[model samples]
Target: MGLRTRPIGFGYFKTKFNDKVLQDEQDVGTCELLQDSKVRIIISQEPEKSNLLRLEEAPLIKRIELLFHMEHSSIPMSLEVDVSDTIGKLKERIQSIESIPVNRLVLSFLGNELNNRSTIHECGLHHQTHIEVSIRASPPAAASTASGSNAGSKKLKLLVLPRCGTKKIPVEVNASDNVGELRKQLPILQEKLRFSLPSNGYFFIHKQSVMDDKRSFRWHHVNQGDTIEIFNGWVTRGS
Candidate 1:
């Protein structure tokens, strides 16, 4: 190679170009190289590290322990409802948490059964307050028979039997109406008869027993102005 002046490869030769053009090309090439390097770096990172940053933040939670003063008559043992829960929801939750039947459970906030579909605040419930829950057992056969007879007199207005020499007043009610609704309308009747509505009382509509005790038979489709017998043995004056 030194003896003969043979033409070398193009790589050995140097060509001159405009300074502005050369600088622009170099800048463009540098920008492309930087972009490619950045992409490679990102691809080489651990996939788990990217996923760890995207996890959602955990929510703040607070727990409260509540002691439900349950009576021998009540089946629900404990009530640990959330502060924001309603009475209805609390009832359901209590039933679920205690493994108790909902039908056999009745919740009393303070001294009264939770009515009006109110919340814990509406029922005057406070943290660490004692909530009394009572259970009502099913009446015996003999008691139910006596209750039927007593209720029958109140509905039929006919005193088939006599007790204490007091005349039994008969109340004529619709077959579809609830016995409780009739009791509300006859406040004086409640006092005069000195009887309380049973929690599990049923209405005998056309010789058929309707188990719904919340509303009177008047709300259902039955014979209009039909007489409904109300068994008053479930609750007593002092109970």
Candidate 2:
């Protein structure tokens, strides 16, 4: 990392040249010659200097694709967002597009909830990386309705991705069933995917958090086209 010439704005004058590299302190006299070369020389394996040099070459991720997985909205809008934008900034962008308050929404990628302090790259997202966007909970009355009768329930289609596998299972679940009930259907899923199910290592996830066993489908506001993801772990990552 230190071999790369880093363009430190207005910082060229601050670094002290290695006198041993030049052979004499008096011989290292031309600042103009150094600026034209644009190289930061580090002869010593000093941990602190190497760390600083690594920071100087930090990767730059400009854009990422976000897949909004909302209960009421199933439209797969492929959004390209700036990686420099922090998670908070990304929320604000979504808020402007969806008109939902940023505080009421959560974003997750690869089964991890993004924090306000993290940038997209810091959150392990890369170019064309897909993320899940959902409401933190059931929206206000304007957005939600009465729970109504359970008889109206329909099949809830979900995509379950195993941690150790690349294929995604199209899981069919009853809208009236709580997320925990999905476990009963695991045998069928295992048969379809031909993959061994985790004995005690998995749970249903939404909004980057584990679903409550007692929460009904009504409480979670699940609807058609909404996903019930199964991440590989006893608990959600970075939950």
Candidate 3:
């Protein structure tokens, strides 16, 4: 007679760990400790067969290096900082070196301005990457003076007086007025004095023979008593 055989059932099982083990447990074939501190149980119908399996290894972590570029066009121009530096800290460093105001300065990476609180790494700055730093000139005394002079020069004042023949009619004119406008006003004098105004001629402003077409004269600079002498053609009568 052949020996009687029984089919073995194979299956996976899971369980939790505690201070006590179940006394009535009968179906469990094996147990494993998982990475999460939980217990795993395996079962098989054959009591002699081992059902335990090993856990897979975890992946390794990679380390990355960071780099950044710094640029500035003002005095004490060049600066190099870590990719971890904050924008606010950079502004403070710049302020210490140059007279430029921190508020007026702007920091940008790859042509984009960085937020005040933004870190260098947040702005896509990488190791060895170059960044452009633009520094704007603040409203200093020199800048204000220059702007004031420009505004003053724009105010219209008599640069040249309109003359009638050799009689010098003493007409008030705008220094801002072009030589062509002056020529138009002196049409009678131009005809009487045989002084046919050249289409392209020069005007004497502040003893300088500035060409009329160049637009060099500022009407605001000319005072009430300023004299503008118009030359006929290219030759001066004395020359």
Candidate 4:
């Protein structure tokens, strides 16, 4: 084989070779074209499953004790749940044991609803610690009116407005809920509004009477639409 470069015309160079040489060149060019053809690459997604596993390597994976308060029942039960799991799953567990449906569930922790579509860790639950739950029960078929049941023993919808920049909270109250029971929700209120209520020397008043630890809402004749006043440990006429 011989290789040569020769000029043909117009200062634009061209090369003329022998037939055998030209054929060899064409074969080489064809080989290059074949080499340049598109090639396919196959990748697997199995590693992505591993990455998903690693993403959960956080402090949110821990075991915690949860307490369930069955509606209308004074007895409470305890269960173990992982902070990594959603509270929705815990509700499922409760439904399995208590025969209550998850959809009808009303769960609260530190007086806050657990139905926020968040994980236990995200909601600040901790490992090996106990939390409480209370089920929302259907009202008795015979109960009626704002004073539906005795001693507010039945549930009534009520609004609680703290005398601050705080917003009003509409909550279901039990006829059994007394002044002390209402005060227990102060921690939740402080957490939500980032403010504090007077720790001492304060009292809650409904109408003319000062609410005491011994009486329920029904004792004060507090109806559904009534608003109780938070006073500085005392009450006066029109106070």
Clashes of 3: 6
Worst 10 residues of 1 by lDDT: 12-21
lDDT of each: 0.47, 0.65, 0.50, 0.62
| Model 4 residue 146 CA deviation in Å | 12
Give the RMSD in angstroms, all C-alphas superposed, for model 4.
20.4
> How many residue pairs collide in each prediction?
11, 0, 6, 3
When sorted by TM-score, best at the front, the candidate numbers are 4, 2, 1, 3
lDDT of 2 by residue, 58-142 (tens): 7855766766666577675567877777999888878888898988888887788889879877787776666788787665563
* Candidate 2: residue 74 lDDT (0-100): 68
Task: Give the top-scoring candidate (lDDT).
Answer: 2
Model 2: lDDT equals 0.65
lDDT of 4 by residue, 148-171 (tens): 435346777776656655666655
Runs in model 2 lying further than 4 Å from the true structure = 1-60, 138-239
Q: Which residue pairs collide, candidate 2?
A: none
Q: Which of the two, 1 or 4, has more lDDT?
A: 4
TM-score of each: 0.28, 0.33, 0.28, 0.33
Clashing pairs in 4: 152-175, 152-176, 153-175
Name the runs in model 3 displaced over 4 angstroms: 1-84, 139-239
